[model samples]
Target: MAKIGFIGMGNMGKAILQGALKEFPKTDFVFCAKTEATKLRVHEKTGIDYADSNAECANRCKYLILAIKPQFYEEVLNAVRYMLTPDHVIISLAPGRTIDQLKLNLGNDKRIVRVMPNTPAMIGEGMTGISCRKEEFTDEELDVLTRIFSSCGKAEYIEERLMDAVVCASGSSPAFVYMFIEALADGAVRCGMPRKQAYIFAAQAVKGAASMVLETGEHPGVLKDQVCSPAGTTIAGVAALEETGFRNAVLKGCEAVYKKCIEI
Candidate 1:
């Protein structure tokens, strides 16, 4: 039996699995994809085993990641709930599936951990937010969970009440960041830069700026001020962005994500 099992080999599932593979032995991981071909392909690519069904995965593994969509939670949990044991730790990546709801599905005794991790896990730069009752998980179990997530990126445990905010802030913010990068590239292209070079320039700038925020611990506003001199070109661009409601647009996008998260 593997130590970690993924029931759905979707994008997010594969991301987390790949990240874990870097930290754990391949033999310690197993997954069940939607089809035999996919299972075989993933097994071939990653050298990880595959279970024939969700129940088999649950029966064989101690830690299970239910990587399926939130809508499928009830169906999948119903299929394997009986296979779950007291020692089994079920990790959920979907938003709005609270610990109480999972407990209702898998019985009150089962341990459930809710996680919100972004797609950037694919590149070892993901940000993950985990939520669970401290009393429910022992120090060793929490440490294991933290290590698993931190293998790919940063992980923090927060109150469940803040999970919806995390869903918008990190889980869905990547899309917004990508859009901003695309806009930056488009502006560069309009100024006669080649599309390919424009993308590289735009992406690297965004990456550098993000690194500065993380490494320097400076306020973003202060960073902006540092870049903008008296009546400088950067200040003019910032004024244009403010005039066109760039910040408000990002806020609205985050609001939409938060609404949909609770709706799910």
Candidate 2:
């Protein structure tokens, strides 16, 4: 639907590119990679074109997504600055870059979109937060992006200011969740369950609980209450978790992640 250029082809970049390509087969695609071998891999995998530099892609693509790490944005943008024009749509998945900073660095002539997405996107179950300072984009822009993210799960349009918290709640929480799952499975093994089976059971239980919250549209507390009968095993487990400051620990973990994102 549109000529899209991705400036990095790492994990997130490849995931998004493949998802978008599947959604819009006719969408012109180009990419820049750090190595020729990496570019060849992308070509073999998706049959997408390659660009000599970010500036080359910026000059040709209607939507240019910067999929590199935030720390490298300045280096990349500075190199590609002259190729950008008022006609291009710039999007970045990097957290530290803001509309004001982008405008200052890339010139006020271009339109801007910013997104923060988590690793879950690799499985088509990602939660993405999107925002744009641009006054308008063509129908093609909305169509391709909506399909690109929808292919990987869900996306929500929110104020840019909330992106830091989005990073806290969804973007970084997956790693915490994985750690929790591993700990639960290890505890199961300690209690005599097979290690592999324990992991399977623990993971499925987490999936079921999360699905209940989503499908039932009920507060997690209500669903949790339904499971925890008075003085029962579930309640006992809940008591132990509460005693360990589970909730406070979770908040503090998220806070620490947010601070790290800011530091980035």
Candidate 3:
């Protein structure tokens, strides 16, 4: 079993830990947060060990996970780079940090993987996009991480170049989807339905719709067509969305996110 060490225990970091724990029951794990308070909270909840320092955790584990915020990458790299060697496989969950950037920070001679994971990883239904341009992760490593992540949600090895778009489409879009769901529920409540019941219906409808698309293996447009019987309520709603440029808004949002990633 692989020894996995998590270096940060923030939101997504916590989600990753939860996902890993649920997915890989046999893998031994250790983790350290930047502060004692977070460590204590995690320990109280999960009964996991808290390493004294990042370097101590990195040195002790064969697989190291860097779950820090983008702002602290440099500091953490400075603290733990010495502990990272060729034998260690490091996964970075920070956005906009390219594999090249990670290599430069850690060292020229190290194995690194960059992963773009969404917030839903908490519920084991997250979508994660991974890439390692420099380190050719073997089938075993790929399978290992895939299985580990599958326990949390779905993961795929994407091209580094596509990561920016992936971040826009999957990583950051959850916020957009949430807002849409909230608005849908609000509309329902305005129409006299109770707020909580509206939320339950709206959330489940969205979930069921997504599941239909996945299970039917059909294009979204085709699945949407199946729902819009000629001149029906669904068609009217879709027409309203089109008139309001719903697709265009999503495209522009993705464009903005992609540009921001490039700037970062």
Candidate 4:
């Protein structure tokens, strides 16, 4: 059986498949795009074969990634469901579409893996949250998914009940991070740094700070304290951020995302 079959060849789907190929070069992969032009373009770029349709992809692969948008899930699932066997595992990437929801479409006995992966996956630095019943997947099946995701970046398995929080925390948070970087770069540009250089400096600094948290295993507040020696420049900036309710704003934004996720 084919290792993975992708239903969409969009950015996330392509990125993830590329990552998996790098790690599991011998594994077979097939994908189906909505248009012949897209299929040809992705084939030329990736050197991966394409299926004639979504159902063909499902029939040929043991694991299927439903990478299309949430709005199209009903249609695609309906089209492909009859082709799926009990041996096939469906991996879903859409937020708010819970395992229960997918089971309602594909039947409760169908094996489903729900994951929330973000835009950073395009760069092999993404964070993904995966959820599936432990007993539903064999060790080999779980390992395959782990390798596919960890080849790109970090992967964590969490309970499905908390999947919506994963949407707010990582799935949709890349846009928030990008906006933060842009604002930081703009502030630096206002302070006389060249625009391009400001972006590099701001982005690298954010990256370094994140690495420090992960590498040092220190609490984020403690890390902030380390940079905030009495009345220091960093402390001054931190004070300004606190004064402007920066943390509150980020919290509110996440709250909004959480609300929208559950609504869908």
Candidate 5:
């Protein structure tokens, strides 16, 4: 019998599978894809097992990851409801779905965990936010779930109320970061750098800068000051960013994402 089963094999689902496989090499995993093409693709790529249907997947695993889109949650959960037992834990990756809503579809006493994980998980550097009631899960069960998340990157348990914020901060922020990298590369190209080389330079600089923040344990402002010498070129660039209201723009973008997540 599989220890865990996933109900989707999309990008995020595949990323989570890659991570979990590394952490649980001895554990059997099964996934139920919507089509035979995807089912064959996932199994061939990852060497993991596949189930013919959602109910079959649910029946074979103790932990079922509901990785399908929010729109399909009702159908998927309804299909698997009769197979779910009290011992099963439902780990949901849909953004707007809540534990309570899941219980209404599955069972009132069902254990559920809602999580937000980003695309970076494809590279084993994902940031995931998880929410679960302490009483709903045993300590060992929680640890296994957390380890599955951490295998890709970082995982933190947060209050369900803050899940929307997590969506804004990490779930949707990778797109914004990619935009910034593209803009930086464009600027370099404008200054006579080769287009391909420009992207490498911009991407590495962003990666290194982010590493410093995680490793230094200092305020970002202080780190900025460290880079900006008196009347230096860095200060000139900082002035331009300030004049363009870069920080405000990012904050407003996050606010917009948070608003949209709540709507969903």
Candidate 6:
């Protein structure tokens, strides 16, 4: 039997599988999809096995990961409900689906973990937020789960109550970051730089700035201050951004995402 099973083979699912394969090449994986074409495509891409149905996949693996859309959660869970047991650790990727809601679908005692993973998992630099009840998982189990997620990128355990915030801060922030990068590149293009080169510069700058924050363990504000020397070009740009309410815009964007997550 496979050690892990994925009920959906979507982009995020594929990304997680890619990361896991890198760390556990010998571990077997089984995936289930709604169609034969998808199964064949995923097999060709990852060289992993496929199951005929959700229950078959769930039964074949100790770790069951539900990567399907939130709207389909009920149907998928019901399909595999009979196969879920105490030994199975169900990991959910859908945002806004709380552990309580998942337990309602399965049993109240089902072992479940809720995770919020961003799109960067595709490149192995994703940030994921995980939440689970202490009673549902042992330390070793949690560590194993963390390893699976950290294989793609960083994984941190967070309180379930703060999950909506995580969705805003990490899950949906990548889109906002990409927008910022595009805007930066557009500014460079306006200054006569080639579009492709502008994108390269803007993207690398963002990546390096983020790395500095992580590696240096310094506050972002302090780092920003360092870049904004007296009467310098960076300070001038910062002042322009402040005048245009750049920080406020980012805060509002995050608020909007958090609101939508709550609604979901």
lDDT by candidate, in order shown: 0.91, 0.84, 0.86, 0.90, 0.92, 0.91
Each prediction's TM-score against the native?
A: 0.98, 0.95, 0.95, 0.98, 0.97, 0.97
* Candidate 4 clash figure, as a count: 0
**Model 6 lDDT, full chain set:** 0.91
Candidate with better TM-score, 1 vs 3 = 1
lDDT of 5 by residue, 1-264 (tens): 999899998898999999998989634799999999999998888888899999999999998998898788879988999999989989999887788987887789889899999999999999999999978788999999998999999999999999999999999999999999999999999999999999999999999998899899989899999999999999999999989999999999999998888788
Candidate 6, residue 230: how far the Cα is off, in Å: 0.7
lDDT of 5 at 99: 85
What's the residue-level lDDT of 207 in candidate 4? 96
- Arrange candidates by lDDT, descending: 5, 6, 1, 4, 3, 2
Model 1, residue 173: distance off in Å is 0.8
Which scores better on lDDT, 2 or 4?
A: 4
Error of 1 at 22 (Å): 1.6
Model 3 alpha-carbon miss at residue 45, Å: 2.0
Cα misplacement distance, residue 227 of candidate 2 (Å):
0.9
- TM-score attained by model 6: 0.97
lDDT of 4 by residue, 1-264 (tens): 677899998889987887888887534888999999999998888788889999999998998999998888888999999998778889999988888888888988899999888878888999999999979889999999999888778999999999999988888788888999999999999999999999999999999999999999999999989988897899999989999999999899899999999898
Candidate 5: clashing pairs of residues? none
Top candidate by lDDT: 5
Please report the TM-score between candidate 4 and the true structure.
Answer: 0.98
Candidate 5 similarity to native, TM-score: 0.97
Give the better candidate number (1 or 2) by lDDT: 1
